[model samples]
Target: MKNVTSLASGAVTALVLSLGLAGGAAAEDFEWPRLLVIGTPGTSSGSFASTNGWGPILQKETGTTVRIVPEDSETQRYRRLTDREDIAISSVSASEMRYQIQGIDGYSQTKPVAQRILWHHNDTPWGYVVAGDSPVKSVQDIKNGGVRITQGVFSPPMVSAVTVGLPAMLGMSEDEVAEKIEFVPASSYAENCRSVVEGKSDIAYCSPISSVLSEMEGAPGSIRWLDLDPSDKEGWNAYLAERPMLIPAEIEMGVKTARGVNGATSNFVYSVPATADVDFAYNMAKWFHESFDAYKGTHPLATRMSMDQFRKYLNRTPLPVHEGTVKYLREIGQWSDEDDTWNNKAIETMDAWIAARQEALKAAQEQGIEVNFENQEFLDLMKEKTAGVENFQSRL
Candidate 1:
């Protein structure tokens, strides 16, 4: 990756130096939409708030009326983008794409959506959190048994983190982790953290920016995030075994509650379907890069949307990047040969999974079995059949 100014320092400098850049910028040859819609998580979500913060700036700068839609369900948002293509782009995580592509878990009956990545916007550095008064100080302390870990019932990403990702981080199997930790059900992401505050669950995974953390911090029990020593290569290796998309970037400017903890971050991007117009993707990326000075202060997370941070995590995304965005990245000398190799491999893997989903659906029909995530027989059949395909495993 090319060396560039960090967002923390560069954002403020750009604000002072290039205050007039967006206003005086020349119009591009590519056409701009009068109205642009961006799909994101519910209004209560940080991602949604982030868009709301910067959406207006984008609209004012580009003369596009940016409309933001909030959907609480990731699968619903994924379906909207893939099946309907009503929204210009939908904010999604790498792990969510992994499940959607494989048609696993909540995506059991659905076909793999053909979405391509646009850019790495910002990263959320989060970890398993506990009440300040709880006995758990580090991740190691959770293995003592009798501890309750919040298992998000509605959110598959949260469920995967607690059930699979967290355990792998500790070098333990899901079965082994289950034996030690009591899994408490949580209805949503907010409820997961609220459970910790309410004392219904001892621990829950969360980020400092989450609005619920204030409640957790002010609660009688207080809030404490379990440490995951960054220098421990063995521990991280195990964690990446299950979640390769997660980055160990430090949370230097995180909320007061997150200070002095190991920083493990996951980048969320605004992705579009493969069939999206090439010029649309190209312009969206180019606009964000050029208008950094105008939108950096619109939201705290918006500052991280700079080209520097985008390139830092560009090579880490597991999804197939859109060709239009690739054109921009290549023009800027950010896309390397290694990136092309990784991107091609990811595209091949995605195509294989899409084909496997079709085969799985056909086999289920022939066997007179209902296709459902809850149906263990159908799940097993999918696993058995797709096991031979190259890069067939789910990253979540």
Candidate 2:
């Protein structure tokens, strides 16, 4: 009986050990990370269908469990992600990232937040869109003394305000350039297009390559995009020098308008993703940058994702290259030691400028020097200076 009891105890111990080993093996074999994706919601008329957007593509590529949550507005998206640090977000603007990082604007007044940006995808150009029947032809046409322009409420307004400053820098006023231009606060791009089609608005600003433009193009006579000339290449290049991720992109024929209107491609800023985490961001960037061909069957636009274009875009925004991205670039011989030295210098210069500006602003405020204008100027300078930095930091 003693021997029998001892044998039973040994059997139970062995069984338990076997079960634990099997569980460990199963755990080691599991290879998916729980990923959360947040972005602007898709529209029925737009090309951002759930199956076609970056979210699905990312999941397919990474073999990770992805949960895509769409927000009604960019502000809301930012709020949710910032408020809940555990949730990861994508499709954030560089400016938004800056605001969050520096605690500027509403974020500054509300709460301090820090975020890691993974990678930049594209530099989205803000387009000035009009109905196909409108007499407005070019950006100069809008500036010809009394043209009424309509800018959408959110992202468009911010960009238009900056562009307004650009014209001011060139010796023009909002009234002089856009005499009757009024801002129409629409809920969505679809609503903006509808307003234009109904003649309730003249021109609405949006991205030329965005799903909204695609929908408007199909609407026939309802919407047409005005081309911003690359003639301001010097100014644009200066902007690009500061913002490396922004490339001089030409809207190809058939993408937006019919042939013969311009006969030549129109130039604009293209958006790209950025990240701070060198390894993760670079890995994400490298995967998308190299495996773009894999998504050709998914979207025709994917064909444009070429290595040459990637290099061009990178040249436009030379922020601290995410380490992972750098590793890939170095492997492909696209980067060199010289590039590293230049990037480090650029970073140092930017940091010094930011510190000096901040100190000056503080001193001016303490002296009661009516620093409102100075504050505004400082903010604008920061906007232009750190556009690429915020994006790079987000990935980290």
Candidate 3:
């Protein structure tokens, strides 16, 4: 009887061990799709240090393995998207995406990426910076010339948009202004800041009220921010309309001081978060909109993330709303049938505008009028005026 009992115990132990091993094998066999996140290097330390900015949070929310692919430059980040990567996050402006999808620029090597833009988020602001002791006080002051502003370190798209595209919208050519100011390229934030302090550059172009901007605040009264001229409201507004991210923002001194100038009011920077994929963009939009508190808890910049802000900034642009996001917005009654009608009409109008521009270009070419692709302003005005007509047609 003792031998028989010992044999039974041994059998039970072996059975338990076998079941445990089988269970472990089954668990190991279950695979999850790896999420790839692409980001620009050196901008967000928090993002890099912590798993690609949203990787950790997303992984915790969804039971998937998140991987962050950090690229050394913005161009590299966008170029990587050509591969069959699962997800990528990079600083692609709305205009850049539009041009890429249309194959307007040199991005012809890559096919148009079929992904949903999840959500557009705010970036740090871009504004003119000057020496604290300098007599220049406003965007207008620099317009008269004698002031040299440095772009510092910016992505190719950013450079194109700001220097070429933005000035083009204002009916002024960046090249025309080239003789008036010096354009110095500083690629890194540290290098740009050092240039300003060392007097190698006069005004530095950067975002307003960023951690980097805050660091420059300690520049011992050597540098100050220039306000956009209120008189140039038309130009500014036109630029803002074209670039939805360029919202009106004030730089308060006490709230955030720059170079010891505590409470000055200036329209310095506008933050915008942009994406290329519409469905994912929609999901991201809804997620961020609904989970505002969660995001704000992660970063203070998220304070501007709101439904109203989305309607105000996003709806005005030529970019298409992610279908998923559109669905969410409609379900929440944030968007109406009229809004849909308007969007459809707007799209049709854009198509018409592009067609018209092509026709005009052909006509001009027949007449031997030199078509300057380098002049971005002319192209923008053509698009803007066309979009306006489309808006009117939609209303009818």
Candidate 4:
């Protein structure tokens, strides 16, 4: 009887240990989807390269297949995200995300899409580019007059505002920029950059890693960048006043054309719509961070997508962080109480903006006013209606 009791106890202990070990293995092996789709910039872009770099590793490690779809502009990418169910994630600039969130500029005609950030991908320095031999040396030279700047005649209105609003960094008002700078018409973003290389325009906005810029660099005329001096504190303050979301980053990683220059760059990020599965978002965010070293060297810009950089700009992004990402951050002990406070405030601010816009739209409809961003009356009403909301500004 004593031997039988001892044998039963040993059997029970063995079964308990087996069950515990199996549970641990199950937790370690995350069940990833068979297929995951990612939308990004054009093939010639660094964003596309970075995404492609990690796509294979993600697939191999998690038993998931990754697909990349390249699109040219924010409008096209956002449209695909909303219209196509297959596109699970997309990349966008801070300005583009802000415009989409507020339903401003190109997004004015449609309702704002509820998007959340997965992580900060990279920061590409952007500034004006001119002919290599041009007399224009700094941003101030453009404000002094006689420079033909590209005015976007394209569908994306924020494209035009970005150029026009940049003068504010140098304490030049919109009216002054209008009076001093020659605004030339460019039908597309490619034309905007090529305008300078072709000698049709004196200056155009450029990112250092753009494939078009390499062409501009090798062109007969050559290309030169006009950097915004970071030492000028007042100028940056004014610049931030106009576009607070932008950051002054020293150019470290980009094409040869952009080396050794300081420029204003918005945080380029990867994000998904609010409708994304919480577990999917959480697992994806965790896996990417944990596997950062595997693909960080895939491209020049990919090296910049480190955990340090992601956390550095986490709180400053225009959109709120995804709930799943927040959960992962908490799990890893990376999240702090301060981050939680900031995130909640960001959510409240977004809610306020949406509510104000809705109220403004209803009032406009009742008053028979044209409810469009192009209409000054509608814009003014938005400002007036949202006046009480904290940190409410109609910026793009």
lDDT of each: 0.74, 0.47, 0.47, 0.71
- After superposing candidate 2 on the true structure, give the runs of residues whose Cα lies further than 4 Å from its correct spot: 1-91, 109-118, 122-125, 153-159, 162-170, 174-191, 194-202, 209-224, 233-248, 252-255, 258-282, 296-309, 336-342, 349-396
Summarize candidate 2's per-residue lDDT along 1-396 as a digit string, tens digits: 000000012233311110111211232243334443334333441223422445577777677544544454645555554543323444454554544445455442223333433344333455456788988776556455455545446555434543463354235665555553455566666676566666777766555555656677767675676654556665454433233233344545344463223212111111122222334444555666666666645654444445665565455443444455567678779888877785565455435444544554565457554444335654554455445433332110
Candidate 2 at residue 295, lDDT? 65
TM of each candidate vs. truth: 0.74, 0.56, 0.57, 0.70
lDDT of 1 by residue, 305-361 (tens): 888887767645567889878877888888888889988887888888778878888
Candidate whose lDDT is highest:
1
If the candidates were sorted by their TM-score against the true structure, best first, what order would they fall in? 1, 4, 3, 2
Q: Where is model 3 more than 4 Å wrong at Cα?
A: 1-85, 88-96, 104-106, 113-116, 151-197, 209-212, 229-233, 237-255, 258-285, 300-309, 336-342, 345-396
Residue 176, model 1, lDDT: 77
Evaluate model 3: give its lDDT: 0.47
Which tens-of-lDDT digit does each residue in 1-396 have in candidate 3?
A: 000001012233311110111111222242323342444444454334333445566667556445554555534445555443322454354444544444344443333343323355443345556667767776556557676656645566445544653455446666667756566677876666556666777766555555566666667774676655434556655555444334443443221434233111211111112233333434445556776655555654444445765665444444445555677788688878867775565455445544655554555457554455455554553444334443211010
What are the per-model numbers of colliding residue pairs?
Answer: 0, 32, 23, 0
Candidate 4, pairs of clashing residues: none
User: Which consecutive 10 residues in model 1 have the weakest lDDT in total?
Assistant: 1-10
Which candidate achieves the best TM-score against the true structure? 1
| Candidate 3: Cα lDDT at 46 | 35
TM-score of 4: 0.70
Candidates 2 and 3, the one with greater TM-score: 3
In model 1, the runs with Cα more than 4 Å from the true position are 1-27, 129-167, 172-204, 215-225, 231-233, 240-245, 362-381, 390-396
